[model samples]
Target: METIIREDTPKTPYVKLDGEKGVVEIKGRSIPENSVEFYKPLIDWIDEYGDDPKDNTIINIQLEYFNTSSSKCILDIFKKLELLFKKGFKVQVNWYYEEDDEDMFEAGEDYQSIINLPFKMIEMEE
Candidate 1:
């Protein structure tokens, strides 16, 4: 599958979904006017990628901040990943939060608790 890349904007995150490499990355702020619309293609791409996913899939999430609507969209992405994990493919999510950012850390923990996929909370220097 072709790689999907979206540059980060003031109100959206940078996204790179490489099916061939089995790597996904999302970074920056995500408070789009229409969260669902902004993330629909991404979710759809994951669905398509699921048909013939790589043996090992990794998603790196490094968001500085996100609004409530974006949070739901993020969860949808995780749910999609959860399905892939259940199918027996090796999947992991690396959630990166800036040092001293308690809220971000807790957000990662929240997603970790809800999703069955393995999650690694990474602390990054501010």
Candidate 2:
């Protein structure tokens, strides 16, 4: 499986999917004009990874902000991860938020509540 690495842009987030380690990360802001275009490959990658997953699969989400469309896409990502968990794969989602960012923290909590995977909410100093 190939890794997916995309640098952050003004209207998008930074994505780093390490296939070898089974760790995927999405950071920065995500308010892209076309959410589908931005997240299609990511969803596909997750699907493929889930098929032949590693012992441990961790998804690290550290977004400052995201639009409604991006929110749906994020949910889709979590759903895919849940599938991996159902297949007996070790899956975890590390949701990172700034210390004072209540909205981000709550968003992470919402996702945790919906997904069956082990979701850890992490508070970062920054």
Candidate 3:
């Protein structure tokens, strides 16, 4: 599968989906006007990657901020990964939040509670 690389824009986040490395990264801000449209390809890519996934998959998310719609789109991505995990694949989410950002930390915690997968809450320096 081909890797998906999207640079961050004012209303979108940077995304890198590397099937070879089994790594999915989403960074920066995600506030797209049409969140679903913006994330559809990524979600589809995850679905495709699930077919012949690597032994271990790591998702690194380091978002400065995101709108509610983007949050749902993110959850959709996680749901895809959760399916992979249920199939006995090694999948993990590394949610990186800046130190002292209570909202971001809590957001990660919320996702951890909702998703059936291992999540590492990483604190980065602001």
Candidate 4:
């Protein structure tokens, strides 16, 4: 599958889902006006990538902030990854949060609990 890359906007995150590289990264803030529309293509890309995923897939997420709607959209992305993991793909997530950002840390924790894949909570130094 071809890679999916999207530039970050004022209300969205920068996304890089490279099937060849076996890496996925989402950084910056996520507060798109239309959460579903903003994330649909990304979610769809993952769905297609699931068919013949790499031996190991690493997802790195470093969101400065996000809104409630974005939270749900983020979950959708994770769920797709979870399915790939369940199918025996070696999938892991690295959730990065700035040090002292309790909210972001807890949000990562929440996602870790909700998703069944391995997750590494990374703290970025201030």
What is the TM-score of each predicted model, taking all chains together? 0.98, 0.97, 0.99, 0.97
Candidate 1 Cα deviation (angstroms), residue 110:
0.6
Candidate 3 Cα deviation (angstroms), residue 53: 0.3
lDDT leaderboard ranking: 3, 1, 4, 2
Write model 4 residue lDDT over 10-85, tens digit each, in one string: 9999999899988999999998778999889989998899888998999999999999999998999999999989
Q: Evaluate model 3: give its lDDT.
A: 0.96
Candidate 2 regions exceeding 4 Å error are none
Error of 1 at 105 (Å): 0.2
Could you give the candidate ranking by TM-score, starting with the highest? 3, 1, 4, 2
For model 3, the run of ten residues with the poorest summed lDDT: 109-118
**Candidate 1 on 3-106: residue-level lDDT in tens?**
99999999999999999999999999999989999999999999999999999999999999999999999999999989999989999999999999999999
lDDT of 2 by residue, 1-126 (tens): 899899999989999989899999999999988999999999999989887889999999999999989999999999998988898888988999999999999999888888898988899996
| Runs with alpha carbons beyond 4 Å of true place in candidate 1 | none
lDDT of each: 0.96, 0.92, 0.96, 0.93
Residue-level error in angstroms, candidate 1, position 25: 0.4
Q: lDDT tens string, model 3, 1-126?
A: 899899999999999999999999999999988999999999999999999999999999999999999999999999999999999999999999999999999999989999999999999996
